[model samples]
Target: MLAVAMLLTLGLGGPWSGAEKAEAAPAFAKGADISWVPGMEAQGYTWKDKNGNTRDIIDILKNDYQINSVRIRVFVNPSNDYGNGYMNKDRAATLAQRAKNAGMSIMLTLHYSDSWADPGKQTKPAAWQSYTFQQLMDAVWNHTRDVMYAMQAKGVTPDWVQIGNETNNGMLWEDGKASVNMKNYAWLVNTGNNAVKSVSSGTKTIVHLANGYDNALFVWNIGGLIANGATFDIIGMSLYPTASDWSTKVNQTITNANDMISRYGKQVMITEIGLDYNQATAAKSFVTDIKTKIRNIAGGNGLGVFYWEPQASPGYNGGYNKGAWQSNGRPTIALDGFIN
Candidate 1:
């Protein structure tokens, strides 16, 4: 309790005003995730050149685009040259501060791994490399409380939080993996829920599951948690156009998830969804179509759709994936379309 209290004191706290409820939005929320760094190299652009430059996702909302919010990922401790950013409570607090400074609501993603927490790489942070199960639970609670408090102190509390990224199989996977490997998956997930609940009194905590366009199997895996009384405030899922038309896929996706939400009386958020513009000429339209389909299915049902790293264009300087992305890779048009 002392730890959580001290952390919240550093920065974080708040319930958005009633008027701030996307109340003016005639439809559903259209949001994107973009963060500017002094130096960042993804696949193509360099960071030094784009240094001090800003890639404001909120610009879409403030400008002609109708975007209502932005999402940002925070790592426990990225083991890369991204130089210890958004990796800890302090960094997350910094990013959240900027988001609120832009007058935007935020969706916070907690990557349990030191770098990324996608299904393929959910390694626990170095500090917890050998932690016992109970120790890891302590780590999760301490970290969650610290970050939430930090954000509140800065007056940048996230509107929603993903307890762990695309955790389809479970997180910190040495023993949490679900598929034929970790028998403790459910317990691990519930432990994480308790961690989130400790600091989520005014925020909505989401359990995220990421899979290809057709993710019924994985979603069912987590749905079992809900059925078993695991607590969560949102049904969060990640969608990518891997096997079928994203639009058609998202349609079924929303319906399937909403069926669960309708049953549980919970809200939903398409926490991560996108089609790389570099993949095809139809990339732009592909993304726009998914956003529209999501909104159509969730219009009044109160669904939130957030594009994942849709703005990961080349930095003016070198970045992590420098050999791949282009400077103008972000689909500004696609973003404008979704929000509008």
Candidate 2:
């Protein structure tokens, strides 16, 4: 009993009279990709709770909706375009700090470009257009490290960092296209991975791809990366299913996630998911089912699920209709899936 008391007094075990308590292990992460919040707020947008009480969006997400994580995307040198740009490193770091202050974990996605990098497009940043292969690799490392340093300056260490966004065929165009030169893609992934580790070793690195339900694509993409000696900690995916097909897509995605875990021994994260704002009922069911299924993955290899820009209303960004927020400036029932 004396030893126990002494340990407690030393703040090593048990509750103390005044010392800070140890943080509990993080629960299954329910998250939101609200990278548009800053820009939206700047445009005079405000969020309201279900009861119509005006509140900070992050507060509503964390307190009312049970969202414990926030995913922010960082672009290298974004233009002033509202939807296509404005998420450069400094702004991202500021948003990350705000999310951290609200007691939410952070996931930093490095797009390595001025705009979107996805399955359909992976254009290199214009400044990096003239660089050779070696210079491109160096640019990747430097940009990643610089972003990490920016986050560090804000005293926010991201819990997870994605090297690229929805890189189905690979990123950085012809130089790093998987079909044409997978070795170059692998090298880029390694460079980003190494840069992230150099800043914060505890930050897990993710290589993301779109279409989480496509097992063959994952097999080809991830298998190629592994074959060419790519190193990463997690396999991230994007799943955007319509109201009618969500059930089927969710099941298929779960199967693909399991295969990824067993084949490569890496964890899986659903980095992006959404349904149309008008399909609130179906979206609720879809989110509930997918979250439950992902949590049930064997060995706890499933990391978390993040709704893509759930705060946007219809027509906010070039007719993006998939946001979970309603036109009345409140979240729809779709976000209720995270409440449990």
Evaluated with lDDT, which candidate comes out highest? 2
Tens digits of per-residue lDDT, candidate 1, 1-340, equal 3344323323342221121221122235567665433123233333211233334434534454556677777777665655423346666667667756766777778887777688787888998899887677667767776677777677775777788888777788776676744435555555555545455555667778775344466456655666555666777777776424655776777676667556667666687666654443345565566666656655355466776655455333234321112455333344444545
- lDDT of all the models against the reference? 0.59, 0.86
lDDT of 2: 0.86
State the lDDT of candidate 2 residue by residue for 1-340, as single tens digits.
Answer: 2343233323354332222111232557799998999999888889988999999999999999899999999999888665443799999999999999999988999999898889899999999999998788888878987898898888888888999999999999989999999998988898787777666766888999999999999999999999998888999989999989999999999999999999999999999999999999999998999999998898888988999999898777779999988898877899999778
Please give the range of 10 consecutive residues that has the lowest summed lDDT in model 2: 16-25
Task: Give the number of the best model, judged by TM-score.
Answer: 2
Runs of candidate 1 exceeding 4 Å displacement: 1-27, 35-57, 83-86, 180-183, 242-244, 262-265, 279-281, 314-332
lDDT of 1 at 299: 35
Task: In angstroms, give how far residue 70 of model 1 lies from its true place.
Answer: 1.4
Clashing pairs in 2: none
Q: TM-scores of all models?
A: 0.76, 0.92
Clashes of each: 28, 0
